[model samples]
Target: MPQLTQTEMFLAVLVAIFALPYAVWRLGRTDYYAPLVVVQIVGGILLGPGVLGAALPQLHATLFTPDVIAMLNGIAMWAVMLFVFVAGLELDLKAAWRWRGETGTTAALAFTTPMALGALVAGALLLLDARGEWVGAEGQDWQFVAGVGMACAVTALPILVLFLEKLAILRQPLGQRVLRYASLDDLAIWGVLALILLDWERVGRQAAFIALFVPAVWAMRAAMVRLAERDRWYVALVWVALLGLAADWSGLHFMVGAFLAGAVLDGEWFGTERVDRFRDTVLLALMPVFFLSTGLKTQWSAGGWAVAMFALALLVASVGGKLGGVALAGRLLKWPRGEARLIGWLLQTKALILIIFANVLLDKQVITPATFTALLLCAVASTMLTIPFATPALRQLDTHRA
Candidate 1:
């Protein structure tokens, strides 16, 4: 080739972003173990610095120039904000409240147990990493530990919904129960994230954002209710952008604001069918780029073996803690046997949310890229494990019922 123009290169990159993951996903029939989104994330990693960049340095360098990377990041930011906003919009908190006794107990235990175990793991890493390879430059010991802990605790609500739909149980009573539990934990996950991201220097701006957000949300709700459904969709996107900007300005991260923007707007306002289509359309058209952008950030600077080992350790904490906590909740709440295991496996599905959480931590410099890599690996493995584990559990549950 003589010389590829930037536009040509950018198109080439887009081709790679959609092509590779899809090829692997379809050819390998990875859907049983990993969904297309999961595969896209893995594709991102393979296309990223650690894998493809290592194997084909010049090609990687030539293809992912600064301008091209910037364009991808811009798209990725918008994609993720929309995804997160939809996630928040889908929170069935009212349902969670209706089943408060069970959902509350289970969600609480499921989240806190993994968090504590993950924190302990982080503390161990702090002790072991004599050169400080894991902690970020500006990170305090507590921040690093807490961030990793919270990452372990996350369950990607959107992914959970997809999994439930795949299983043909999205409308079933058990599926609704699981969604309630996940919804409660989703709220908690974001709350913990906000706490971790708190910036003392920007407290004034943060406070202002919080103070104004309430009235703004009230007015927005009023406006949304009066708008036509088509108009509401357009206004919602504007709201996402506005909140994202404000949140970024206040040091809370645009994702947080994006979520808040959606959380305040009732999903019922847009109709369930419409909301579902909106989410599915976004996933189909936008999220693959976000996954690629995410993968491009991965690094194995602390050694692949070290990161793999750490990832495995975190995986154990994430899976085991989730199961253990749910089991405890089952015993306390007197849930039917097999229910907890099924719930635990489903709740441990962490691919997108965990990746998003890790990205935020990396952005704030609270965790080094090595740590992010480890967490990313942990997230992928955890998500891949979910369906295999949950399928058998579901069968066992049905067998019990029969």
Candidate 2:
């Protein structure tokens, strides 16, 4: 392959880096968050070997590679960590504390029902050999089931946060409830994923290490928080380095450490505005590379009946499971029937977190390329469907608030 001129390389990098953020800022002006995901996908296809080269015939292959792809993953994961940390910082711990019982119960119902359903559906698909024969090194049918289950059960934290912010519900009771419950939901799903990864006999030591490391890290963090109250940035830099090293050493991804560190920092220690400012700077600088990397890793050719079926199954499980579970809890809790149903529908949006976890499973070989593609399609579709589906429900909530 011929190498690109320096000019070409520079232009390509510039476009790849700035395109998503520009689109996001523009979309924000119009009050649409759903289009950002579509923009990323479309941008990738356009800049990829498929469209740009076909149209221009002068673009080089230097823009795409495995190493660049890996770097993108690291950046994206860091962005996710910053995003989640900002979320944790935004949590009004006092309010969440008061609603702990309700939030815990609601989140439990919301998560467990979907997970069980996703796993069962995955098992059925595997048993029937729907997505290939599951003949890869990750075992036969059950392993596939667990992998699919984990994917289906995930909720998109970033998307959820964006939606709440857009809907002006972030400071409201319902929004606060959803955020707290969703945080719990994220924690639960991560735990379940860790367990599934271990059960599948992939990275057993890593899983064990995370399980042991989290509390110990938190305890240490608490102590550090007390001492560093006088010098916030000092504490931030130290914790960031410590967590990153610990994650690398434990064989877990550095993003995991970043996230844990952010979660520990919360707003209690650093104040919400300061944390948000730092998060924005990090996200603006590093997060687009992550999304671009995801686009680069996506395989458009991984399509067939099995992939289609799995995609359909993902849609069903994500929607049916979350909606059904939350609806049940809402009724049991004596929330108005309509409000309960709205909660079910609003929780359906899946975003960057789903994609991140999918990438992890793909890297671990827990899921095949075909399965990964299917899940990606599900993530895209679920995210798009969410805004339209939840609009009426959200409008109702708004009216109630008014």
Candidate 3:
């Protein structure tokens, strides 16, 4: 019978985030395909408009009031920026280069085929699409088409790593090879995103950022190497904030800067084990809020069936394109069918990064709320399908090899 203050609501929100996902994860035993992250994502959507808001407007309003949403968003922003920073830091460019021929071919095929397929789907949507805000604020139809398509091409490198670790293959040769392939795609995904988000008006500022970033990165790297590992953590946060500000000011978005901040840093300097533990801490504690905030943004005003249909189409594009690309590479490179099949399925697994990419598209108005809803659905489905199908392939491959 009482309305809670913003602080109280925030606490309640946090409690619900952690409690709901953990309960569903533990009780439902969704470990194989649906991890805690997937559970959290589903919980977020259920907590958002398509379900909860559509069903109980009064309760949804009471819990997620304007002030409460703003506060939660602020927390989510920082959490995601840091989480993205960690993603960049974990990339192994050298390893990708070392296995360049195989990794390059596979990554290229995986990305390009899905991108083209997704673009075709988007183009088909464009013939009759009536949503105005679905297109970028200052962008064109081609940009939206390409943007949505690339969204399908993404593989959540961070989530892939988690899945690999869960399967007890993080250190295995196969796991390491897959990581290399995923790492290259990670770089390409961000590059294409930057192209999609290009603001002609801010071209000068962006140019300045490019000119300044190289020196700043050098200085930051040098200072980081000199500092104690314990102190580097504190410095890294400060650096993330500063770089994020620069990126935003240049119209590139703070998340982009956060990623770049970590990308330039040597993962070795941070100690792999400590970094892993820290990543886990962020995912366990802060990322749930980000996921909830993401859920709050979901909208399906364009008809649930329409969104579902497009999502289904995009899902087909993502899975089929990834598998096709990998299959073609296997043929050219002469890899076994089982290994290629397993790798292709794993590469199709999408989560955090794809969601983040879609969030950016939504933020920039490059895609409408309805399009975002479809993409989000596609991402979740793509991720959940991974373990269930890939596990069988992995087992068969192991048997074949043995």
Candidate 4:
């Protein structure tokens, strides 16, 4: 038998990366519950060490050789950076501010409530485990708890956008309201991440990065405004890359920089239609590999059952806390009975953002692989619940209106 060359092997891995998810998502018709992105994510896990590697160690090792893994990681890094940057750009802060009173009340409660519940659960795990399997080697107890809590609190803005569009409410008043709330929370989530990633030794560098970033944003915005729309797209890619480099150099991580780069620029410059196409293109072309790379990180070393239970616990905290908070906000704000229920279920969508958050935590060694796996599961489950649960609420609201 002739052995394949390195390039040949890399191509094979790519085939597996793209094929499996499409097959499952299309043939199984999982899109009603799980979007293609979600299926890709689950497929990635299936291809990763815990399942495929365990089942066929030799094939896994041979297919994902060191060079191929490196190549895949490279693609995943850029793909996610692009995804995060688009997410930041899509944030309509103006709309959020316009409705600040209601949006603030809803966003604040929606975020803080789940955070607290998730933190409590994390602390409980610490008490029960005794071996500290959940916390990362470089993490403090507080960081671990805070990271987990934030994971629960996050609403994946990009995923929420997808869901809204799917439900045919993307342009409606209710969809706009939900987007405003998610936008504010999206900003808060990144701020909390910066805090979690703070290193005392690198505090000065981080401060300098923030200081420099203001002028950088000013320059980027000025340049973007003057350029032709065609030119702006190319320039934006350069901007994302530079900020990613700067952010990583400052010990804050490239995704942080990528997001900051997009956050400062007005999405209007790109045109909504173009932005939508660009985001969809990135997802279709690049993010499958990112999902695959994410799957490769899954570990069940602490025992599969333990991880499964932890995921379930986190899921309850995420779902229940989100609904509870929104329900309270509805009562306080005098929202119609079912309005908050609809919003709560809509905001419960969490996939891309939560996975990215957990990935950062794992990268920073603030959480163990087992903990990351649990959070990943919680994210997938939460996102899957969004469409199923929200559809009913939407119909009920429509009925009431009728």
The best candidate in terms of lDDT: 4
Q: Per-residue lDDT tens digits of candidate 1, residues 1-402?
A: 599999899999999988888898999999999999889889889899999899999999999999999999999999999999999999999999888988999999999999999999989988885437998997889998898899889999999999999999999999999999999999999999999999999999999999999999999998998999989999999999999999999999999999988888899988899989989988888988888888899999999899999999999999999999999999999988799999999999999989988888999998888998999999999999999999999999999988
Per-model lDDT:
0.92, 0.66, 0.89, 0.93
Off by over 4 Å in 4: 129-131
- Cα misplacement distance, residue 32 of candidate 2 (Å): 3.2
Candidate 4 vs. true structure, TM-score: 0.99
Off by over 4 Å in 2: 1-11, 20-38, 45-60, 65-74, 84-97, 130-143, 199-219, 227-231, 301-306, 398-402
RMSD of 4: 0.9
What C-alpha lDDT does candidate 3 achieve relative to the native structure? 0.89
lDDT of 4 at 246: 90
Higher TM-score: candidate 1 or 3? 1
lDDT of 2 by residue, 1-402 (tens): 787655566557657668754676486653353555555644544554434545665543565544555555566666656665554455454555678788878888888887788788777765674454332355445556766776666777656766777677777877777777777777777666555445323366576666867787677666765775558666666666677666656655555566566665556677656665676675567656666665555454444566677788888998889888898888778886467766776677776667777766766576766666677778777777776767788887668757
Compute each candidate's TM-score over C-alphas: 0.99, 0.82, 0.98, 0.99
lDDT over C-alpha atoms for residue 251 of model 2: 56
> Which 10 successive residues of model 3 have the least lDDT summed?
130-139
lDDT of 3 by residue, 1-402 (tens): 686888898789889999988998999898987999999999999999779999999888889989989998998899899889999998999999998999999999999999999999888887776646356455589878988889889999888999888778889998998899889999998999888878899999999999999999889988998999989989998999999999989998899989998899988888999889888999998899999999999998888898899899999999999999989988989997598899999998888888898888888788877888888899999999999998899999989988
